[model samples]
Target: MNKVFNTRYLVHLVLAGLFSFLVFNLTYAVRPSDYDLKEGDTTSASGSDDPDVYIINEHGYKRLFLNPVIFNFYGHLGGFAKVKAISPSTRDAFITSGLFRNCEANDEKVYGLESTGEDTSILHWINTTGAQAVIDDPNFFKKVFCINNNEFNWYLKGSDYNSVNQIPVYSRDTTSTSTVRVGIIEFVPQNVVYGDVHYAYLKKTSGCWLSSGGEIGNYYWVSGSNQSIHSSDCYDILETYSFLDIFNNLSKGISKNVQRTIYGEEDTMETLHSVYYIKDFYEKEALKYGVSDLAIDIDVKGPYMLASDPPLGGRWGVGEGVCNASLTEFFVNEAISRGVDESQYDVIAYVYLGDWQLSGRSYEGFTSCATGSKSFMTVTTWRLPQEDEGVVTLAHELGHSFGASDYYTSPCPQNPTLWSCVKDPEGIPEPNKIPKYPQTKGCLMAQIIAYNKPGSDEAGDATSISNLNQAVICDATAREFGWR
Candidate 1:
């Protein structure tokens, strides 16, 4: 009887050991918490009384876990089943609050026997602590970091609790709108300078008109009686005949700077029909010279109204102003039809003071475009004989299209007494000191080139006209519009 009893006791002990091994393995396979259910979501489990406990936290997560009864009694019954719910915001708070730093903390063991490996032990610790954390604060177990309670308090206290670790947001009025915007247009001329208030020299400068070979040639008789309409054409003629010829004859000017055969040729067509075909080509060329990548097509509905009553106030006069306004409007309408939205383009009428007021100051060219209008428009004015001044006038007017400020100082009392605008120590600037307008010379607004002055230091420097400088002009314009 004693032998039989001892044998039965040994069998019972063996069975108990088997049960312990099975339960430990089963727990290892239990699913963890999910934290991705949305607010107001309900989840159901195999044996849960309430299926509405699942909720997603701010960070969006969900998890599954063994039900309490299954966690305890399932091992006794040799069954494995669990409940599931969305992780809550408390987990996020734990991480943000510095409760646990990394996976190492999550791997700690809390209630269960600690595993030998550090990672496994910590995971076990966190699994148990997570449940307790939820009990302490229903939303506390949202993140893995929150599984460790001691670390959270320690971080907050050490950081003074006032240090904001997250980005803050501010609100602005969202419904505000404006019906109208304002704009302005101005010009720069040849051979101007910019300086500081203390007369500390800032820069010597040249205007766009001067740099582009404008106002450098004699007037051409289109009809041998009619004057040339385009100012640039006249400048080109002078560049070809007067400057190039003289320079070429003296000291290899032809090879050194003129590039006569390659650079000095004009359009070969003598007939009006031929000229018309290439009109757009010429205009496009001019636009490129102005440093704009976006080209404007020439709309020559008719010849520039140079023959109108009272000579149409050539270039920037009041009559020219009216004409410019009309042209700008026409182009603006076309752009709008081609899918450009309102306010995308501004049109300004550039009017020189002499032209608008009929001051008979023909040499003092004038032009204006509508202020703040994205579409460019200008009625430029020049002398009665505009042929010789094409380059200067055209470049001056185009400068406004690129948003350059005027370097010319008006006698107005309210103007800023800034050093760069006017009053240079060297008696007005000659030659462009800075290549780009802003922070360089007086800007395109001053519209003056170095050669215009007698005996200027930079008088012979053609390097200013290099393609690099041209590129700068194009670059600056592109930058203003946030383009390449």
Candidate 2:
């Protein structure tokens, strides 16, 4: 009896110890100290000051949360949005110089290299000295091992340097646009692949005529230093990210704004092409695909203006940068020519600045830059035409008119990552915060700008309209426009 009792007591004690250990682990796991939400399983996280919100990637469903109020803070992962400050009204101008090279005269100033590093002083010094500074040296942006999001995080940019650091100095002016201060800072992301470059800009909180996120405008450099630049770069990067974050924020925003338009909000999209134009394309393309004929509610037009006349002098993609008040009329003309009625269609055009220029069309496809007033999508005629690639390119840009995003995997000079959507074990949709649909493997839009092998014909061939490609491009576009 004594031995049995002792054994029983020992077993009870062991069980209790095991229970205690389990409870401790559960508490540690449930209590997310860094994340603010303590209620039911947190789908997303957001902080007023921190720009980088933590996304809960449970199984695959993704969610995002944001600070109730908007304000600026140093090192915010998402953005430095000023509270209650009116976001400057966005513009509807078709094209701007910085983004599209198709229309503007070649300008060297428009070209810039953004370095993702921790040291702004080093970056600034290198830019200033040009050949004199050795900023590209790998030793400069060293790494330290750390843990983030339950994984080991390797930082390429070194720890905060002892070099001079600046503080919150706001030169935000509400007066002349030129006097307003705009600054930039750079931070190495928690995860750094070889060549993934991200950029952003936002308006500061102030009672001004114009600021960031308003009509397309240039940001003037305020007093900048390593610390100041660091803050600015972080601010801009997060702001850009915030702009993108909105895509996933809404239940329907992602599906709606998949194409480009002049001034349509995410919810209420403006017309693309005239009813007639849309119907014509739909009738033609639909029959080819054996898809049901859908009535056209929107108008569409394209592939009309060549950015360059002869595709020479590195001016192959310059014609797209010429939007002003005149562009509205130009869009009207282009649409009308394509059997679009101006009354029913929203005319869109592309533009660039007179200074932006490029030599080879090697790196990427055309871009849609915006005038502070509008957005423009331009084509690079000089670069080797990707033949069938152009059709995908056109569809891709047009897709933007409907608010679709680039699902393409961005490339690096050395190593590039392919674009992939989050999926389940059975290849089903994983409910991610961002709706990542499976994209084409080697699609024209998927690959960052690679020209079609040199001598392909201009008009797209049957292979160009393959079932797989059509499903990814055309069908997706149709869905965005509500045509499907």
Candidate 3:
């Protein structure tokens, strides 16, 4: 309240005695089809005198990012590709909505912008004592507007918090993961619907994460009963069931972005196995990868797999006591000892102790339980510190682990009706050296997939593999797992 107001350049107005606000009614018609800029992506008018960047919201609306401080506010949302330049025509394709960037240095006050028209909006100060924040959906913040002290003079003065038509803020369990919520929303098309992408208010106790509204719950969104709602209905229908008590209530398994449930894997402690050597590094890098995974259905769950010491002992790095072959041998031996069901579509993840060369490796297929690997994956920290990230390298390796039996076998890919590593002594000359998986032609990173390798180009790798969450499963591999 002590801060000086910058009302010299702007007029102070209080309308209707309850609300005062700004109007940014852009008249540009939208094609929707012309929108290539997506949510979480920031774009500005190409070569403008005064470049104003906007992050696309879920409904394809563009909200003013305000300034650098506001843009950095949601950096927990992971990344922005340096404010891409879009044509002025392309930029106008989306309607400009109210601002959602936070203006307060503290959580003392927050504002919500309710759209009365395609352009007109009214601001309301959230001042309710028990008014729980609508963080169940991150995108909800996109539609709302946030104002600073200077702009505060130009707006509504009363605490008119409308309870109905409520919004869902991005929610997460403060226990299981350190991921934060953001106002980012992907601009999903209107014609299509999505069952994926959900958020839930969760808590953890006694080593189990509990969610009253998620995939297995009766909630409208996570249960797939009404994903068509798209985080609407004000979330009143959600968080309805509270069973934080009773031994039988806690969720058995939980995948993330809120809910990517993976049950029956008691030992899938994805982060713990890599904590020894990469502990400090893993803690920092893993979060970005985890948040990034929220965009894709495949969220980063873990480096939770077999390693040299693992739970049985201490930490070890690649080429320390295990090379590619020896590591596979160790993993196979562990699987044998653990009676690991190879048919269960199981994968063992190995990580770098401190740092190691050969950044990534994964067994393509199972030959025999005793002879070949149990489809284990290894992600080293070698080249990660240079440019690529450790979790990203792990994602690439995990993609290979999720690959189908057809990748390394005699059967040709159904989509292209062809195969790589062609058996032509006349061309490759050393066709025999090319593994049956045609690994030399790339794709199957059976033992190792390194940046140091001479050639590392595959369609899936080029498009989606390295990204934590970008697209669904790609070609040269089954879109679905073999167990499915």
Candidate 4:
């Protein structure tokens, strides 16, 4: 009886072991297909030839996993799948696929996970902290998932994707109107962009006319004439006079030191004029207006010859006087070549040795004619004038550059009828009026030529007389220039 019982017990033990083995095989077979995947085999979870380790749900719309997950999961196994490591470029492609839907109806969220070779055990914590955390915190989503256009293939927040190559795929707002949309992703064109080119040229003329009595008055033939209009030849008179002589004569009587009280404080300022001598009239005038400060400083340049033949008009033609435009171009070019910074000088004064003409009349001088606020060039014919007329002319022209207009009443050569109707036609109320006129009578802008009649105060050797009183800027003129 003991031997039979022992044999029975051994058979029962064998049967029990077989039954346990069958049950284990059945359980393994019935398990999910994804769980049965081997290290070397690919899983249908990601639809790639990489072992799947984690399942990612796209807001209940689609489920997928990254390719690198397989290599990262079974890295310790000798037969683990051989896959490339995840890169920024690959990660961008996954984000741009548009397979992931918005996690919330009104909220757009994106999340990304990077693998650590040490162990995927931390992946289990993803349920409580990974994608859900990104969805909860918009800042975290932007920091980790969103990237600039230059860094990724898609446009994220603040990414400039408005070019033709990159087209926007997302709406700017949660509205039905497509008017506001995000930029798209495209390659930047390899081409250069250019801006508009600006070119300017001065007007050309054979000759210019100078009016004796301002813009509108008695006309005298200065240039392109054989006979002299004044007692002394205009050319000879201009050649004999010197700017230093004129400066010394004009500066006489006027105090170099000035005192003023501003903001309850007495301030004294000394004005100094540093004069520089040049060889020719053009250089002198150029340096005067170019280097000489409006309030101080004076310098001389060269007696350089004309760059090219002067653009003069035909003999006895309407354009027989000096072309102010041509002279301006010539002087400007010379200053540029001499290494003189044109920008340094706020004003340009052209002192011609001979009389020039403008607007069909002969004149001693003119200022701010051709170019208005731009480098206000004062063209003065250095001919001998009666009394302190030369000095007055110089002061008057310079005044025009300093926002003073001619106060004289003269009809516009082009529109005589209209100008004649107005009370000081030459004095336009505008700030930078071309051929500005004076608002007051007997002011410098009104009459630069001094008179020495019996009743005139501007008498004597003319050189000794100071025209400061006549040429001083008026209150209206000062107001126009914003000098209250």
> Model 3: how far is 182 from its true place, Å?
24
lDDT of 2 by residue, 1-484 (tens): 0000011212212322221100011000222233332221322112222222222221111111222221122124334332111111100000000000111233221111112422121111111122211121111111111112211111122232111111011111111211101111011111211111123232342443224343322232211112232354233432122211221122211111122122542222111121122223333333222222222232223334333322221232544433344444443344455554333322232322111223323323223433322234433221111222222343334334433434332232122332232112111111121332322222222322222221223322113321112323233333333322
Candidate 2 whole-model C-alpha lDDT, 0 to 1: 0.24
Model 4, span 21-98: residue lDDT tens: 000111011212233323222222233343333221221111223334433433433323533233221211121111
Better of 1 and 4 by TM-score: 4
lDDT of each: 0.25, 0.24, 0.31, 0.27
Error of 4 at 398 (Å): 2.7
Clashes of each: 74, 65, 9, 35
How displaced is residue 309 in candidate 2, in Å? Answer: 11
lDDT of 3: 0.31
Candidate number that wins on lDDT, 2 or 4: 4
How far residue 340's Cα lies from its native spot in candidate 1, in Å, is 18
User: Least accurate stretch of 10 residues (summed lDDT) in model 2?
Assistant: 90-99
lDDT of 3 by residue, 1-484 (tens): 0111112211121211221111212212233345655665677777655466776655555665544555666665444557878875455445454434345644455565554432234566543232223322123344454444444443444445433122212211111222111110011111212122223322222222223333332222122223333343223333322111110112211212222343421211111111111122222222111211111111122222333342211123323312346545554455555554333222333332222222122321111111111223222222211112333343334443333222232222322342322212221211344342232222222212211212224433222123221112222222122110
Model 4: number of backbone collisions: 35
Each model's TM-score, in the order given?
Answer: 0.24, 0.22, 0.23, 0.29
Which of the numbered candidates is closest to the native, going by highest lDDT? 3
Which segments of candidate 2 are over 4 A away from where they belong?
A: 1-291, 295-341, 346-366, 369-375, 380-389, 409-471, 474-484
